[model samples]
Target: MAKLTLPPLPYGYAALEPWIDEPTMRVHHDKHHQAYLDNLLKAITGTEFENVPPEKLLAGLGQIPEKIRAAVRNHGGGYVNHNLFWETMAPQAGGAPAGELAKAVGKEFGSFDAFKEKFAAAAAGQFGSGWAWLVVTRAGALAVYSLPNQDNPVTGGDTAILGLDVWEHAYYLKYQNRRAEYIGNWWNVVNWTKVGELYGRARK
Candidate 1:
């Protein structure tokens, strides 16, 4: 019901250095993600949806009013997904999953390398603006999924534990036309601790 507000970046804009540049990070967070939050707030104002929290709206999208559904779907999803995406990385994060997440990755995809390969392929293969996700299906299995333009695994009955923004704004400033390179580089900054936490909570 209240206005959707932009969440702060977990680390400084420049923290994702070498992979994602500071200017890009600043624009991506301050401009792109904030636009989504502002638009979502505008889209739902004075409607029945106005009172719903951004996360709750995302989690129960089917209940959103038909009148503003598309706007909310796009903007709200951008807000929610990007928030998760930011938190899913840390300046000092990345490398490999530890604890149960490492074991699960091995079990699900044979090894972390294989998991990286699959996630990268999925992210690269997305035809346009969208996201690549590591999700837990309702059937209680872990899998990779790609959703077009702000659409997310939540819509398909999966719990997203990890995600990568494949939108041009997410990479163009740094990687130019080399999205694959961006995807490859992103693996180096993944916040496995946050991911592990999401996976642990979702699995339970």
Candidate 2:
């Protein structure tokens, strides 16, 4: 509500190329994510919501004024979702988690490969525009699920350890209609370091 600004990409648009491509990152980060921030600022400008953090606003969305609830939900969620999406990947990242994260995933999903299979399936099977997540559930274990549109597991008391934007805008330019290919390649860019840190935070 305090004039959310688009987060600058920590890496160049072309850094994640070969898998994500330059044009898609440009539009996704600069144009699309920016639009969500701009619209969210306008939506909360004169309301009681002004000054609330977008993540806090979303975590407590049920308390928002009904008239502007939908705007805040869509745009605010877009803002939070996109920011996390960017943080979840890096230029040369890949392989898998280490330390406690590896232990957690292995304990919960049998093994890291099994976890990848489930997570990738979630990303591939999601219909239409949505996000797939690996989240720390309320029960203190990892879980995988996909949600429609910009919705995330946070509102339901889970912490998103990883998320993928399965919306066409995320990979349409490079993958065309091949979302499975996109999902498979996406693992190569996984910033498991960041994800493991988030997993630690979420566990506490």
Instruction: In model 1, state the lDDT of residue 112.
Output: 94
Candidate 2 per-residue C-alpha lDDT over 1-204 given as tens digits, one digit per residue, 9 for 90 to 100 = 236677799899999989999999999999999998888888899877878898788888898889878888888889999999999899999998999999999999999999999988988889899999999988889999998898867788788889999999999999999999999999999999999999999988
- Cα lDDT for residue 137, candidate 2: 88
Ten-residue stretch with the least lDDT total in model 2? 1-10
Per-residue lDDT for 115 in model 2?
94
- Writing each residue's lDDT as its tens digit, candidate 1 over 42-81 gives 8988777787776677778888878778888899899889
Q: State in Å the error of residue 96, model 1.
A: 0.9
Per-prediction TM-score to the true structure, in the order listed:
0.95, 0.97
The segments of candidate 2 whose C-alpha lies over 4 angstroms from its true place after superposition are none
Root-mean-square deviation (CA) per prediction: 1.4, 1.2
Local distance difference test values of all predictions, in order: 0.88, 0.90
TM-score of 1: 0.95
Which numbered prediction scores highest in lDDT against the true structure? 2
